[model samples]
Target chain A: MSDEVKDPKDVLICRCEEVTLREIEQAIDEGFDTVNDVKRITRAGMGLCQGRSCSKVIARIIAQRTGKNIEELLQNSYRYPVRPEKFKIFDEEESHE
Target chain B: MGMSTAYYLTLQGKRVLILEAGIFGAGASGACDDMILFQSKKPGINLELAFESLELYHALNVDLKHDLGFENYGGMVLIKDQKELEIMEEFVQQQRMYGLDVVMLDEKEMRKRQPHISSRFIASTYSPMDAQIDPFHVMYGFFHVAKNLGLEYRKKTPVVGIEKQGNGDFRITTQSGEVFEATQVVNAAGTWAGEIAAMVGENVPITPKRGQIIITEKIPMVGETNLWSAEYLVSKLRPEVKTEISEEHKALGLGFAFTRSFGGNYLIGSTREYAGFDTRTTMEGVNAIVKQAVSYIPLLKDIHFIRAIAGLRPSTPDGKMILGEHPDVPGFYTASGHEGDGISLAPITGKLLSDMMCGAPSDSRLEELSPVRFAVVKGEQVQ
Candidate 1:
């Protein structure tokens, strides 16, 4: 796990952002610092699907680099209205339906 | 006011109730880019509070035992011209004086860090203190922890009316004929704070400032750092500052800002318009973001936009949050008017409001954020 993420040409870790392991390593090499740093610079996890797609791979890369266990790594916060529902659904009479 | 306040209150062993018009993260909290930055904050209590919140964010995941995807990506404010360089120079001085860890990055150094940055930028300022979090997870974590501590939540409930009882209690009637009784009512509603305050016959000079965002298809890290134009600071603090940008764009409050989301999408935005509660995304706003963002990071021009979105930020005329109890209404309190900083300020907002509600001495900073400040500012005779 530690040495596996060094290759920048690795397969897409995040398809939504189109981030690769190589770019993640470059972000870290360029002093991007933390997992969130790589996410901000390379967008490894910031995607339309909201990282449900690629966070695990990105986390694995981060764990490999930082020498931290994958389980110990920080995950992104979740927001409410977590489900996508239109405002019309909240209308008093409409909500009943 | 509702969720975070409930969290701290429940922790204090108090009975708590939460009523949401929609599900959590539905409002500004969910829609905002998860940046907890202090560089552009209005240099006094706002920066102080942001610093406190930054500390809270650092420990929050560990404290709540939830994964909040917190990271210090650092932030860079681009200086596109000599005027902007001067402005950033002064701004950096003020920020440093306020104990912020900010350093000026010349064009060469800035380019070294963020190679994709435009050559049009002469200089920039970098701060490691700026960071991002997944707003959805933050809210979810807070709600989960609060609920476990005995917080009661009723979703799909909208307050239709408010009546004051003879004993100083407030009775809130939801649209579905549900009634909620409480000794005090805190208006933590985002853009709807004004309407909530009006229900108690109080005025909280809050407005809905619409901010539009554009999300790009996942691509390699084209730009480094959470980037913003020095104009963003100018627009937020002194809207009158003149720039070569069109009056139309200026009116829309367009400024360049781009950050990578945890999901790999680049969330670039935004435009601030007083759209009277309308949260719809406009072509003009989205176009401005695209034009300005591509100008700073030319690589963005080749990328396709995945989605265009907008959110209504709760803003005050004076650009400060309104916390504490309303001056006239005994138990009717306010914890709104955070503007774009709401996501960053939620933790402290909740704790401070809860402290006041629990009969603890008010934080001296709360004195300035008093709901009464607006009254004093207007010199309006409180009837």
Candidate 2:
């Protein structure tokens, strides 16, 4: 929203996946209206942070462009393993036959 | 499944209305890997239909005018030991005889192709015909084109009832009390298709088989081709090998499938368990997949997985999809129960079902996949 930011396209919205603002805008223009749709098309919210870092930013962008409410757009589904846990943590016991 | 069916039907100049129980790509279609695998298929109608389906995907990429993220990166089946190697050897030969471009790769050749693979794998099979397409892209591609061609769809509108009138017409009632009347109906609800058929007094025998997959952050390519384990394939092809698997692994229905998405994220999967309709990924399932994957490709342990997701695949008893008109329920059709093969066979299934509806003569081989097979097995009349 600020003109001080030089070339918003070059700015990275999703640091984990390194998706640029331009990529997110392009996905929206291509008719991917929903936040989840944009995430699926462009790898914006599908990284290590799991969209916690960029989903709101992307939702705001969708609202500004599509005139849809940001509240409605931010209804992205959350999955299991709330945080980044190691695979070894879940490997407790193995019963080999 | 519903999207593809709608696309084909609309392309044939028929007015189509899609009643969705949820948003776009909300079910298994959204949560699945982008694999249109060929090597994993059994050597039968399943394999034959996959070849045709691959051809259709190529055409759909052009017809839809959108990048479906179609890629022919090929696939590999890692053979862990001599037992799996022996079984895969015969499997590959049979698939080759059926005109598949598949071959067994010795350890030397396999390592040359996939240097990152662990030394535990003795050999592998390679097929140049194996491919992948983004599920979201494909589903939305069909939807976009079909919508422009007069296909109307309502999201979050679940069908509550389906009744047949005396004059061979269908009355479809939605959960919102909205009623729709059509001359024909297609139960393409995937996992819930059995419930849809039951409304009309037909038994489709579709069960929800849950599969879980984990997604890693963007990483370098692990191998030249998408990967699968002959361990699971062998077990599926020869169920007698179940005794060799551990109880935990058996309960998890563990297998190895690692495919990279167009976005550079490696989607490592999965488990095949009958957990009814629950689509929640468990710690046990995710851990098993991670252990199996790390053991196969040690480099994977360093990658950070971002998310875990689960989907319920509509599995049938015979391990084949039901795709035809219900002989007892006239003017009604069922195109469900693809299990894991739904992504691979979506295009062909839609085309065949639409062709059948339009009175176009279809491949006689499809008769084996008909819903009537269930009835005939029950000693009912053939026609």
Candidate 3:
């Protein structure tokens, strides 16, 4: 009844670049406290899916442990540019007055 | 210059190019309440401009002959308190000064005019001239007309890079590694105009303001008079009171407003979040919007929410437009950052931008809407 839940070593959340539970725990041990900070250290959120896969688990873990409101905590991060432009086209016609 | 600038430019002779970062009207111009009403703007010039624009919309509806879906279904703005009623009354005086005919109606009058509204409202201001339009139809109207008139447009291209050449023309670079040499460029990139300006060493403080909306399924009396809270519109203009939502006013909230668009799609908006380029709707935001909107029109309680989306309005440090030619740049002109009013004033902007770029005389009203003011401030800031 008094046992701590051990994080599954093989459980992986961020599949794009292959981040595992052990790695997340290691970053947590290294004082990367917030979801943003953990993502920065481990690149957990900067994958093809852009944190969508790992954010919820990481947010829940942080919220439960940190005693923060999960709903409010989830709203903390800012999403930007929405689209990463791989290409753009412009012309001198548009550049001129 | 006359509207002939756009006409003649397309007519004659030069390669008339329109720089669209996306599909025509895909930007903030397409994303607005599309209220052509002067219900909430300051009296005097602002209301006059909105009313005149409303009239222009009406005229265009007749001239364009049903293509634009120009609507004149009359708008009703509900007021929950006399404080709001006072503002409408004051604005009426100013609208009268601008030759606008507005009616200051009481609760009974308002209820008679728009019975769908909840009786809790103290009063409502109905501008007989207020109207709506299908934004897509109107924008497509412009694009279709422009296209048929032989104006060339490039899509999915951003004017990211620019070089001022010795010939006093511009060499603009697209993200696609394509460069085009054009003698004139119009910075109508909507919310992204500031970033576009930066490519040309021009600084435009075009801040992107995210306005989100929730559409409710067609439910009768959910509201009428294009119902909106006067407090929301007022708070939007006054900085000190902008976000100040008292505990009592939580039902209304800050910057909270709504407008029932045509087509049975209620355009309930908006929360002005400064979330740059994040168009995704958050549950918190949607919930807040629904809560506030329902509070104003309790009838909305029964209405089911269909969907939620967001549009970024290009808001300047000052709330007005940054139009006209670049003050220092020899050949660059801009018509951007009308913020939430972009849709309301697009025709005027397009007309004025064409006039200014052709190096001809412009309407005096154009001066009030010039980007040169932003340019001058940019000049001072950069120095």
Candidate 4:
């Protein structure tokens, strides 16, 4: 009757760029006062889809670590070329074929 | 003067229907590792052309650089095993062949660049030219830009059928029973290209490879760059390598990878399963991914997992994209099967497709990506 993930190992927060709870705590211990610093060191939420999936959990980890509200320190990182179309999909031309 | 190509036709300021069965990025584009990767191409995979596409992306910074969430976030790959080392070597050579500015660093250099890596990880290949992007946001940007440019979009509208008109134009029927006529058509439907193409009496070989991934709660900044176990890339090539055991599927352990997304979250994945439309996650798969990830970054043992999700890569027979119009059909065109390059390759596709529709020539060499190579042409129709 519990919705919580059973195995502590499988209890993932971010889906796109895999990061873990223990690692978040460790980041906090290392004096990472903010979410961006944690991200800079851990490389979480840096994958294809970016952090749309993992940012909140990361904020929670930062909050728990710094005893600071997540909203105060949570930062957003944006990168470009959002879609990596399949190779052949990108260069479709009618001329060569 | 008028542009006859589909993209041009729509932009030439007319009604254009972009049929989506679901929301934006819900298809193959939604289900990708989304690496704006230009360094991982094979020796014969047209690395030069891929770089050119990256350059096109660079030029789009005016629009793409906006909170479209674009960043300089460089790319880095970790070397954990011999098999991966081989692939990295090949990748380095391919990049170097085109006078690319990528460099392979030794263990010390890698550690210098990525201090978050476990002491065990010895080397890395860092390419500043590679960057990351968010898929959904970029698509939204493209949709808005296209719409502003006068393109009509039909969301939640799936094109169930297409009929060849006696004239050069074609009839496209939507699942909603809405029928439309156009002189030109483009199939950018991602994984459904095979079935979508069948509507026009053509064949597009597309395989839907599902990549399952899991993220953890925010981990400390472990690495400034993306850390990938070359082993997974090698395993993608040679699936017989020995990896940890998994209970769900035999391939889970070997199919694992770790990458830092642009949002400061860790992405652990991914098992490449052939399960059609089955996007569910499994314990065995998650275990395998965690095990492999910890081997390089021992700190993950303390972190918690967030969730598991899958993205479908529009894999093609040739590991290349199928672009341009049909060789045989006058109006039907294709822009699908980008295995994992959908996010990285979109800007390039938009411009090229636009140029093709305008009957204007592209500065980039695309002889290798012509869509007609995959299909046989029949008779021509008058426009």
lDDT of 3 by residue, B250-295 (tens): 4323455556655455667777777778767675666667667656
Ranking by TM-score: 2, 1, 3, 4
Query: Model 1 chain B, poorest ten-residue lDDT window?
Result: B374-383
**Local accuracy of candidate 2 as per-residue lDDT tens digits, B230-328:** 988898888886436788998888989989897888889999998989988997888888898888888776667878999999999899999999888
Per-residue lDDT of candidate 2, residues A1-90 (tens digit)? 564658868889998878888988887886677878888777677777888968899999999999999899886567666766555444
In terms of TM-score, how similar is model 2 to the real structure?
0.90
Tell me, by DockQ, which candidate is best. Answer: 2
TM-score (all chains, Cα) for each model: 0.79, 0.90, 0.72, 0.72
lDDT of 2 at B129: 87
Count of clashing residue pairs in every prediction: 25, 0, 15, 75
Per-model CA lDDT versus the true structure: 0.77, 0.87, 0.63, 0.64
Lowest-sum lDDT 10-residue window in model 4 chain A: A85-94
lDDT of 4 by residue, B1-383 (tens): 00112334455564666766765456755555546766566644445556665776566556533344565556777777666676678768766786666788888888887776777666778888677665555654455455656766555678898888787778888888999988877888777888888777787888877777776555566766665666556655656866434445454434545556545556677776676766556555555566666656665656666555666777888999888777778767787777767777776676677667667765555767887677654553311
B124 in model 3: Cα distance from truth in Å?
Answer: 1.5
Candidate 4: where are CA atoms >4 Å away? Answer: A1-97, B1-15, B43-46, B81-87, B236-250, B253-257, B362-364, B376-383
Cα lDDT, model 2, residue B238: 88
